[model samples]
Target: MLATPPPYPSTIVTSTNHPEPPQITIKPVDRRRILASLAATITPFFSPHYPHLNSDQFPHIPVSFLPVANARGLFQMPPVRLSNRYFLVRAGESEFESLGIINTNPVAKTSVDNGLSTIGKKQTVKAALRLKEMGACDNSCWIWPSITQRAYQAAEIIAAVNGVNRSNIVPEYSFLDARGLGAYEGKALQSVSEIYASDLVSPDIKPPPINDGTPNESVADVFVRVTQLMSILETQYSEDTVIIVSPDSDNLTILQAGLVGLDLRRHSELAFEPGEVRFFDPSSIPTYKQPASALYKCPNPPSCK
Candidate 1:
């Protein structure tokens, strides 16, 4: 019968109709876990901090006030003009993005604030595919911690699908977390939108009332933080391309930083949907050549003028 199927121990039967499976070697160490741990530890230290010096001594300068340069020196590159370009992507839909109810009020009768909940798998897979189609797979990504679980998972899926190494993903906290909703954090967007129309009109306006003494940050704060992060990225990744994942509010703030000259009041005018990807090239913006007179203003009253 079928030539006795060959001897069991001495010989193995061949399947000429089927191809042999590819060999997969497992590594002793999990390199992805190591890289993630390293990134988490070192990322916070890279956040740019604004000094609290006196305005008279050190006036608050706008990003446009900086000079432009290409070389590496003290005033080499412009603080706003990046030597390399990157993509800013809004994280995929969580409950918040989907317009679901979230209750920030701990004492409220009803609350649905599931901290760190991620989006559905279908959306995650779709987002990853889109990023790959856009050529994002060619570079590494920097993601925020709040959205890390979902974003990192998507990155992993993308890498696996493309046979890419998964170690390129890193965590970044420079981009501020989602706008603290305070009492509104856990409330449904529709309910909040209807209840607090005026305050929602401009995030910088009177912020939502505190929930249990927890204060939320204004849109202006987000603008300042985003600008600082942009400066840091421009300097650090001057010669490389990178991807950033952030929430809708923070992503809008980033676009505002690049488009509206970092004006806080103008931030409300910008809107970005979740999972949207936008490209920014700092070099496209014309550099502001500071007037010589403006450089050294007379500090001693009007006598010098």
Candidate 2:
């Protein structure tokens, strides 16, 4: 019948219906085993420090110029007027390592005293008070903290200053975890320098309190959360909404990358200190694209819940 199906070729007949599974290529992320090694690579190449540029100083640079990476995908929002929104302040001038080390683990405070810590908790409160004086106080105000203690504490201090009850503050814990690229949790909090060197590195990767075994949220993840949070705030109220964020340059860079819809490599470097506040009025410049929801997921796993 039909010339015996043209005498099926052995390789063609077997392979046609069932092709071999595509090879799964996983590039190794653990290139450096020591913190020093990773830090050496990143810090020198992209020096994480930059002086704050004032609007007057940069006459050529618009008060709101989109970083080149995000120019193409930028979206326009309403105009930003100073009377409408308050400054979105990052906390103090603390170094990344010092703050990271202080709040790396959760602390149990019996007093819950705002003025008790040298790590800038008191000043953070004052900063929020300043915001309140500027007419930014509202029950619907949003406050976000990364999963880290420093961020959480910093936000808590600000809420305290504003007299914003715990129930009123919106905690977007998902925005925590400064690790830029994606990787397993628990291990992600390690400093860039700590993770890459062989001799200095620990053999065991710490599992996150959230036990689902997923990597900590990526930089892309936070950007998406920030965008969604913004949307939710916008939908609920037509007026200006105040937001408090606790993130440094690395985290901000990722947020910038996500907002601009640019590839990871396209983002400009960023650095924000603790207690430092920078205001962004979405109305002032073109609104950047909010990242797709597919890239965002709760950083905490079920176990943590």
Candidate 3:
């Protein structure tokens, strides 16, 4: 039998407009103990069958075949965790013709009216309602920091539509924010594409040059950060579901990384429209060498294709 998890530290704070702020509970795991148990159980299962299999035919033996200490060490490493289900949603569209341009352009201005258009808000609400109908609202919601205003607003709408309190919404910075576009910000979508034509067309990963006086992050940087975050989330919420709201380009990058295990250079192959939503199982993500084509084979909207 599994031991009971220790009570996690939780606190409640009151807001001026609302009686209470959203509640956040964090449960810490005993990594060493878990790894030890896993190694012990897995070793015995594989030990009896090893001699029956041909090592020459199967060059990559299971981790369980390793010594107990080695197995434990491998299990204890980072970026490995039990699988968890998650939902990814793109933020509603703003005035920008294409994604990322507005964020990259320092001169561009954003306000309640211009940031999320009326149609964008409606689409987000509809997407949230669809999730709620599908029982996804039971899980906590996480939104990207850059699009907090619109993302949180959509979360609030979701909570209201689901007849649940809005305390489950949280903000995360792991999602690639538009500011990473640097000099591309504020420029027309076509102009930005023209500037980075070589980078976009090249089969190899070629990160765009950083513009002066702007924060710049490459596709690889975002991939690494998001993958680390996925490892942590899977471990912490192994049996629970969660939602993530982010921008289109950022969402596509994450989806491509998770579904195909492709390098950052292939990020353009996958795309997402504003307010689009998709389901994913973080634990089952395969490596690039083991491509899972079926996961990403579904038809997409015109923009996504």
Report every candidate's CA lDDT. Answer: 0.51, 0.46, 0.55
Tens-digit lDDT track of model 2 for 69-137? 111222222222122343456654333344343222222111133112465665567667766776566
Q: What lDDT tens digits, residue by residue, belong to model 1 across residues 243-263?
A: 665544444544445443644
| Residue 10 C-alpha lDDT in model 1 | 42
The most accurate candidate by TM-score is 3
Comparing 1 and 2 by lDDT, which wins? 1
* Per-prediction tally of clashes: 4, 24, 3
- CA lDDT for candidate 1: 0.51
Error of 1 at 156 (Å): 3.8
Model 2 residue 142 distance off true place after TM-score fit, in angstroms:
3.3
The model with the greater lDDT, 2 or 3, is 3
Stretches of candidate 2 off by over 4 Å are 1-87, 91-96, 99-117, 138-140, 180-221, 256-268, 287-305
lDDT of 3: 0.55
- Roughly what TM-score does model 3 have, to 2 decimal places? 0.56
What does candidate 3's lDDT look like per residue over 1-305, in tens digits?
99876566665566767767657677788998677556654554455344344444544555455543222222211224444557777667765543534454323323453366677788788877777777775654433323445555665665677665555566554353443565565565655454345445543333355556445555555565566556555545546666766644554554455554555455655566777777765455553342376565546755454
- Using all chains and alpha carbons, the TM-scores for the candidates as numbered come to 0.56, 0.43, 0.56
**What are the runs in model 1 whose C-alpha is more than 4 Å off?**
1-80, 96-99, 102-120, 139-148, 154-164, 191-203, 212-215, 258-263, 283-286, 292-305
